[model samples]
Target: MELWYTEKHTDSVKFSIQVDRQLYSGQSEFQRIDVFDSKEFGRFLTLDGYMMLTEKDEFIYHEMMVHVPMAVHPAVKRVLIIGGGDGGAIRELVRYPTVEHIDLVEIDELVVEVCKKHLPQTACCFNDPRVHLHFEDGLRYIRHCEDEYDLIIVDSTDPFGPGEGLFTKEFYGNCYKALKADGIMVNQHESAFYADDAIAMQRAHKRIVQSFLISKVYQAHIPTYPSGHWLFGFASKKYHPTADLNGVKWNALGLKTRYYNTRLHAGCFALPNYVEEMLRDAE
Candidate 1:
C-alpha cells in the first residue's frame, strides 16, 4: 500500500509527499508532531501538519538563515535562536568558529525530543557545548534581556497557533530592545505568492522596519513550502545585508554549501518587480 502526507497551503491548493514509512506521530502540549521517511526527501519533520525540515533540502533553509547574517557581520559572537526546535540553524552556526555561544528558546520541548529521536540530521548539533536550550516562551524569554546576543534568529512556524506572538509589533520591539547596537535579526518572513501568506509577510516586514534602523528582505527556494518562494527578513541597527556584506571574508571560509554562496547573497536580495512593489506598499 502507498501512504502519502498532504498539507493544505491554502483551501484550494495542496502539496503531497509519498511516504516510505511513518516513524513517529503524537500530540505535544502545543501541536501535533509527525515524522516520515520518503524516497525524495528522506526523513522529514512536520509540526501541526506543516513541513518544517527534510533531510535532503534542509541545508538550503538552514544555510541561508545562518550564513547570510554571519557573512554580513562576522564578529557576531553570541546568538539567540527562537523556535528552531529542529536544531538545523544551530548546526550551521556551530560550524563558525567566531560564534562563541548559542541560546535556543523553544516553546515546546517535545519538538526537540522528537527531532532528536527521528530527525537527528538537524537535531545533532544540540550536543555542542556552545548551545543552551531554554524550554519557555520565546516572546517572554526575549523581553527580559538587553544588549545580550549579537544576533537573533526567529526561526518560527507560520503566524498561527504556537507562532502567533512572534509576528507581533510588540515582539519585534522587544527584539530591538534585546540586541546590541550592531545586532542583526533574521526572521521567518512568510511567502509572497499566496494572498494569505502575503498578508503575514507584509505585516512582519512592516513591524521590523519600524523596530530596526536597517531592514532588508531576502529570498530562498524551498520546494516543500508554499509557492516554492520563501523570504527571510534581515533587520539590523548598523550593517546592510548587501552593502556591508563581507563577501570576501565569507568566501575565504571555504564553506561547502548546497544552496548558499557569496554571489547568491547579493542576488537573493534582488526582488522581483511584484515583490518589490509589495514590499514598498508594506512601508
Candidate 2:
C-alpha cells in the first residue's frame, strides 16, 4: 500500500505526494503540524492540512523573501520577521553581514520546536546570536513597536486562521508605524492562480497600498504551493523595489543563492496582465 499525503488546494483540485513514512505528527494550540519524508521532496511540513514547505523548493521562497528587499534597501541593519517559525527566512537573512539584529515573532512555540527537531536544514539558524525569538501574537507585537526596525518580513501562512489579522488595514497601518522612516516590509502575498487565494492576494495588496507610498507585487514559483505560482508583497516608505535596487552593491556581497540573483530580482516584478488587472481592480 502507498501512503499518500494530500492537500485540497481547492474544492475540486488537490495535490499529493507519496510518502515513504510519516516522520512526526502533533498538534499545537494553534494548528496541526505534520512532517513526512518522501522519495521526491525529501522532508516536508504542513500546518492545518496545508503545505508549508518542502525541502526541494524551500530555498526559492526563503531567498526571494529576504533578498528582494535586501537588494533594494541601501542599509538594512535591524530586521523583524512576523511569522517564520521554521526559520527559513532567518537562514537567508543571517548571510548579510550588515544585518545586526533580527526579531522573530511567532505565535506558536510548537511550530518552532517541531521544525528545529524535524527540519534542521531551514531551522538551524535559530540559535544565531542576532536572532531573538518571541513566541507571541505578531499583530500585538507590532502594535507596541514604533520606528524600531529597518526591515520587516511577514513570512506568514495564509490570510486566515492564525494569520487573518496580519492582512487587515489596521495591521498594515501598525506595520507602517513599526518601521523606521525608510523601512521596507515584505510579505507572502498568497497566489494569483486560484479564486480564493487571489481574493486574499488582492485584499492584502489593497491594504498595503493604502498604507505605504511604495507598494508592489512580485512573483516566484514554488511547486508545493497552491498553483506553483506564488506572490510576495513589497511595501516601503522610501524605496522603489526596482528603481532603488542597487544590484551592484548586492552582488558584491558574494552570497550564493540558488533561486535569487540580481538579474531575477528585476524580472520578478513584471507581472502577468491578468495579475496586473487584479491588482489594479483592488486599488
Maximum-lDDT candidate: 2
The residue-by-residue lDDT of candidate 2 on 19-81, one tens digit each, is 999988998899999999999999999988889999999999999999999999999999999
Question: Which residue pairs in candidate 2 have backbone atoms (N, alpha carbon, C) closer than 3 angstroms, thus clashing?
Answer: none
Q: Name the lDDT value of residue 128 in candidate 2.
A: 91
Each candidate structure's TM-score, on Cα atoms with residue i matched to residue i, is 0.99, 0.99
TM match of model 2 to true structure? 0.99
Query: How well does candidate 1 match the true structure in TM-score terms?
Result: 0.99
Please write out the lDDT profile of model 1 over residues 51-96, one tens digit for every residue: 9988998899999999999999869899999999999999999999
lDDT, residue 72, model 1: 95
RMSD of each: 0.7, 0.6
Stretches > 4 Å off in candidate 2 = none
